[model samples]
Target: MLVESLAVLTLALLVEAAIGYPGRVYTAIGHPVTWIGALIATLDRDLNRDDASPAVRRAMGVLALVAILAVPGALALALQAILSGFGLLGLLAAAILASSLLAQRSLHEHVAAVRDGLRAEGLAGGRRAVSMIVGRNPESLDEAGVSRAAIESLAENFSDGIVAPAFWMGLGGLPGGVLYKAANTADSMIGHRTPRHDAFGWAAARFDDMINLPASRLGAFLLIVAAALHPWASARAAWAAVRRDAGRHRSPNAGWPEAAMAGALGLRLAGPRTYGETIVNDAWMGDGRAAATAQDVDRALALYRTACALLIGLAALVAITALALSR
Candidate 1:
């Protein structure tokens, strides 16, 4: 089972990297993440009552998380069971489905768009492109700010959007990937400290942090390795920055990759930034240059691509080892 799971993970990464989820398919049938989001929205509407006590809302949030995971988990298991009977074809189908959970190609495209926007439309274009990937206030950002924000989003999402899902799928196959996506989607939808969500989103936020723990470290390690391979980047600096600054960032998991990318590229990230009217005074991730430009964004993207390639290589290695042991 472990061998099969790792094989599926390797193929899924390859598939997603080759071709991302298509826009036409998304328009026609919606996405797995969107479907999960819709369910979360409904649960929030029906169960997360404004008038309810905090304790009750917290309990309901837990219930909502369970419900959110159960639906997809069961379906993934059923689908896996059915596909297993089909032999190699079943594995391919499962890999295709699992590929949707990852964002390797999409992340690269989005980050590249930020650099393209800056070059083409100046700061305004960069802000517009960066806004799509980050939750921070783009209008408040200057050229350097836009560049840093794009790099930060790329680094953090490298863990959350790529590594985490792949890690889970490599362990538990379809069900693991689906469940991680469901939890991650839930966290993004409702995991805020707002008055309405602080209690209600408690479980989703905490669970996401917990499940992401291993991937966060692994992602930082991959970035470090990629840095070593890059001519201009420094693996030693990346590792040092992770050790020094990853623990200081506001988020438990985001800082790991952000710090590694920052050090690898010799740019600071995740410093104090504004989201709406709110200002988050977080510590800088690296003691490097803070004046990040579109060129810096390009460098970061290169490092990110290398890290992703490393992840695929690791999955392939694991799959091969598992297959050999099984035989």
Candidate 2:
């Protein structure tokens, strides 16, 4: 099962990486966000109450999740059928084609651009480069702020952008993988405490949290293993630091990898940030060593590259193990 899953995921990854996304009429309509939003609308129709019970809210949340899971499967089957209509091998080629969009190397290079910009042009340049990486307002940051923001985005999105989708897809094929990405995107766009989405986005946020749990810890564990050669990081350092500081953040899962990353890099992450109208004051982690300059950002990138190598290498190892075990 693991071997089959890995083969499928690898094919998908290669597809996305090579040809990239095709701008097709159906694909634009069937993108993950579109489906998630559709599900949210469908789910919200039944729960249009100012006084819905907590039980009712939770039940509705669960129901919404059930629907969200099916959307990816539907998209994959549809895509496969279309590709197969042209030729059976076309379906296989399409799997490889779609994998080109996964963006492993692209993510690394884009993040690295910030560090290079900061080095070449200082804070203003860093801000310009990094604003592209993060969604939050970045116009107001100083050099240190820009560096911190980049590091934080680098660590967190590494989980969502790379690890989580791969993990799910490696387990459940393309449908599972795509749906996980879809769920995460829905949570990011709509999951909030604001009035517009409090109830409507409830299911997405919770389900995203549930789905991210294992991947987050795996991220931390792998970071520890991957960055083992770094002076400040070891398995012990990562484990102790994560246990001590992960609870400091607001999110149940993000704190684990972030704290571990902070600990591994000998820096702090998470604190005050504004998202739109909200001012969220989150607890901090790591030592005050997190007072980062651009130099520290470069070092962090080095660590990240090291960690990424370990992650991909580990994935290859897991694939081998699965194939061996299945035999």
Leading candidate by lDDT:
1
Per-model TM-score, in order, reads: 0.99, 0.80
Off by over 4 Å in 1: none
Local distance difference test, candidate 1: 0.96
Best by the TM-score measure:
1
lDDT of 2 by residue, 1-327 (tens): 456557666666555444444558336555445656676666666653547765666566666666666766588757655665665376466556346325566666777888888899998789899888876577767777788888887778777776788788788655667777768866875567666567666888988999998888887787777567776555566677789988778998888778777777777877777655566798876665656777767766777767666766666677788988888
> Clash totals for all models, in order?
0, 15
Residue 52 in candidate 1, Cα distance off native in Å? 0.7
- Give the alpha carbon lDDT tens digit for every residue of 55-136 in model 1: 9999999999999999989999999999999999999999999999999999999999999999999999999999999989
Candidate 2 residue runs with Cα over 4 Å from true position? 11-67, 78-101, 231-236
> What number of backbone clashes does candidate 1 have, counting pairs of residues 3 or more apart or in separate chains?
0
User: Residue 157: error of model 2 in Å?
Assistant: 1.0
Global Cα RMSD, each model? 0.6, 4.0
Q: Which 10 residues in a row give candidate 2 its minimum summed lDDT?
A: 94-103
